[model samples]
Target chain A: MDYVEELKKDFRYIEGLNACINCGVCTAICPAAEVSEYDPRQIVDTVQHADNDEIEMLLKGDTIWYCGECLSCKTRCPRGNTPCYIIQSLRSLSIETGLFIESIQGRKQLALKRTIGEHMLKYGYCVYIDEIDTEMFPEQGPVWEWLRDNREQILTRLGASYRQEKSGALRKIPEESMKALQSIFDVTGATERFKKIEELSEKKAREMKISFNSGKDDYFRHLYEGHND
Target chain B: MRYSRNEVWETYQKEIADNNFYFARSCIRQNVLPAAEDLFLKIIGTDLGKNIYDDARQTTCTGIAYHSGIIPFETTMTVVAHLFALMNEAGYENYACSCVTSFGIYSEVLETWKHFPEKEKEAREALKKATGKTFEIPKNLVHASDLIYKFRKEIANRSKYRLTDTTSGLPLKVVDHIGCHYAKIFPEKGIGGAEFPYVLAGLIDEWGGQQVDYPERRHCCGFGFRQYLLKSNRGYSVANSKKKFESMKPYKPDLIIANCPGCSFFLDRWQYVIAEMENTTYGENGYGIPVLTYEELAGLLLGYDPWDIGLQTHQVAVEPILDKLGINYNPDMKYKGAGNSNTDSPEQPSSIKMF
Candidate 1:
């Protein structure tokens, strides 16, 4: 595939690029750049001139995964360029092409898909309190511990009707709303994208030495635990 | 586009909806800080005397999913289209969002529509086919805290607590943390723009607190959603907050106020993790600086009972702030019943000198 041609198709990718003077402001201000080797200037240069093979390497590389996506680059760029937006497009192409399965951090896409992706469709909420297992999230602290254990009583005390069939905050979504949401996902191609993630993740799992069985298996655990290093 | 470089902040002081609003809840707020929303509803509806509507049917904004690249871009746009349809069904012209992510996504999607009119037509047609509900674009889209900021003076007039410490008779020090999506994406949209947004600071001023200007004030609370979502990757998120905490530590601020639920969640939760990591604290003894949402701060000053307002749910204890203000809260009931007498209360901090 012509990587540049593929990127040119997304209007966002185009808006994100301007004549690069390469003042290094985005790289200097980027928090991810400070912590990780994710340099916006280098990525911009790489994309601006690199061949299809080089761009494909980026699509399957760790540098693309390092952006926190805070968009600080948008705020500081002298040319009104947004390297963050370009990263978004690169990340999108990476996922669609299943080249994301080639890298460690990119492979963690499967972990995010299984947890947040499935949760978004099923519970209609991201980061559901119940799903936050204490073993996974000991940092939520003891106060969270008590609150999670006594969720219904505590939420009721705070005047939130947790999971009750009522017309207020924290109520369970109705059946029709769920169907409508599902249909939106189906028609908008989110479901297809989701299937791609799962199918590719399973193939990637086989390639790795670790066994993949179910919820947060060894391979899943490795990617979820660290930058797919 | 509406802002002027010459003026102080006349641009952001635009009119906030007083009578009619379709309130959309944030999934993070609904799950993490339920009472913050509860107090918001009570203060706006009962105390402030305004009409607002919230329905169980409103779905999650899916901003997190979309930003994480789990949900396709088209799905988010169509879902937002359905949300607009819901607003039309509710017969409300103003959209008051509760989360920063939702607000940001709405801003992004609206801009998307502006840029790609054809894409807008596609989303509208998709929603029209799925739900058969048509929507007029919102007259104004705002964050819930912006409503409180708009009414800062009025809230000050109604509040029982002042920004001054009653017992000490000195002004309280406060640091304000703005969620990135709140105005970072569109600086003109936020109250004070990207560098100096006053949405929370306005409240601190009107309520009588000294707003501290700290280095790293513009930093993200490290709730880099996808990074923070991964268990092992949370160190980056915590380290970011560590930068903020370290920057502000020298100032000795009384509290940190945040507008975003995710900001409050991470800024609050990460303090404990940092303490565990570094073996030190930012406050007296083991305590850390208390972090609160604007609603929590407003409710506290408005004489709302702390426990009823869900102060107990906070990992960083708020009793010190309450004590500094000379506010009355049942000490034993801080963890037990909000108002009920405690049978087996959680251990209280040693610093408290019981009345």
Candidate 2:
């Protein structure tokens, strides 16, 4: 849990971390600190004083995850310390330690699955599952009606063809590259996540009132708001 | 039309990315036939086909998964190495992405790879093991836009079009939206001048259009991934768009231009979506502004047919501007604009007094 060494080593960009004057300006301007408890000034103060234990605690804490990596602190850090980047570096360290794994893991998978579902089946950008009501996106609305009327035109313009490309036309993947990707999928559990996303996405698509027979056509039409059902 | 010092430095960084380039294929382009690449080559003078090595074992950066966070750090590292490997194979140290997210991922992965030697080694080993290749970050990496801006004079010189108003002979006014990823990720390296920036605005000016101002020019299109994901407030994106629209509305310029597709998508589509949400009329008499890509706008000034340039694909119509200019356009031009006409008088005389 001694992050001082890691912090010092990882953030070589900040040559003099111990030089922070602790004016609290970094925390004041931090977007994450404003919305969440993650204060960069506090992190800098702890690191500057060599408070290794508190540094570790802060790194593992939820405060680290809330930093949006905006680097507003870096720009205004009168002491030239990049607490924003430091917080980000620490957050990655936390992820490596398996902290916040559960919360972070499946959400991306779910979102991707949803996106692929919308892209593949519905042919539109994936809608927020919570915003599924037709009333919220009234079918007769000008945008909706324009899409409905010009569905084919929109699809054609977007260059979507529901049909999969003929396999051999794509650049052939080197066998080694394929093998490496396969191993990466196994190591990161990305294959399973992709599968889960694909499954959930398909289910959501089925639940929808619309269906497109051509994946390419469907995607383009959906992109342009051509199909309602 | 003038670039600040920071903007100039950002252009230098982008030039670094462009000089040592690694082109990534986009899904949209995969379906549409490499229009992005074609446009890039036309605008920037690099033929990706000629520049990229045939033996280069390039792979998808899997940015889609990275943004979704479905891909773990280890996997992301491997993809990063794959990019470096491509660059290394081509004998180039710098890597650049046509897509904004690709640039962001390159920046993110490069930062992470610097710390974790093991991960970097693993990624290098993965590439070597996979393709009998080794990789390393060159001196720098950058986005294509950065590079394009670097060669502004060259692009302007090569340009085939000249601006002349059919009626008044005034140049067109434009507003620019620098992608959030470009500006936010490497603030020092992204476009400069205005804090928000018109890196592409200078490019427009090079091609004969005058760059104009818009409100909320610095704000992200609310497509900040998290904003869209958390669905915290649809208005967050809309407000950003509204600020931009209101700013440009006064200028009553010909078009709103963007370099990044995501920004274009949001700025182009969200006006109607936001207008519906807020129940307010936008544009002239409730019409929304036309959002264009730097390429499309350049193509327009360069005299490329709007239809051929894919202008018709945009949600907000640009035809009205063409009609206003009295340029003869095909009425059947597949693209249509939102329902509104030019009820306002002819453009006001320039209140702009350049310092």
* Cα lDDT tens digits for candidate 1, B1-355: 1224314754555556777888888888887787888788888888888888886778888888887767777889898888878888878889998999999889888888898888798888877777666667888899999999988888899988897877878889998999999888888878878877888878877788888888899988877777888886677788888889999999998899999999899888778777766665676556888889999999999999898898888877887788888899886666564335333433332332111
When only chain A is evaluated, what TM-score does every model earn? 0.94, 0.49
lDDT of 2 by residue, B1-355 (tens): 4445435534433334434355554433332221344455444444222253223244456654444344455566675676676666667755656666666667767765665566677777665654465666757666667666666666566555554445676776667787656656556656663254546866766666676755556655545343233332233355556666776677777667776656776787676565556644445545567777666655565555665555554555576556545556675544442232212111111221100
Residues A173-226, model 2: lDDT tens digits: 455555556665555545655555445434444545335333333322342232
Model 1, span A1-229: residue lDDT tens: 8989999987678878987788899998787787777899989888888588889999989788788878888888889888988888898899988899888778888788878877766777776777876677777876777788777667777888677776566777777677778888888888988888888888888887678776678877887877345
Q: How far in Å is the alpha carbon of B345 misplaced in model 2? A: 30
Model 2, residue B170: C-alpha shift (Å): 2.4
Q: What lDDT, from 0 to 1, does candidate 2 have?
A: 0.52
User: For model 2, what is the error of residue A163's alpha carbon versus the real structure, in angstroms, after optimal superposition?
Assistant: 5.9
Poorest stretch of ten by lDDT in candidate 1 chain B = B346-355
Name the lDDT value of residue B75 in candidate 2.
60
The superposed Cα distance between candidate 2 and the true structure at residue B311, in angstroms, equals 2.0
DockQ of 2: 0.16
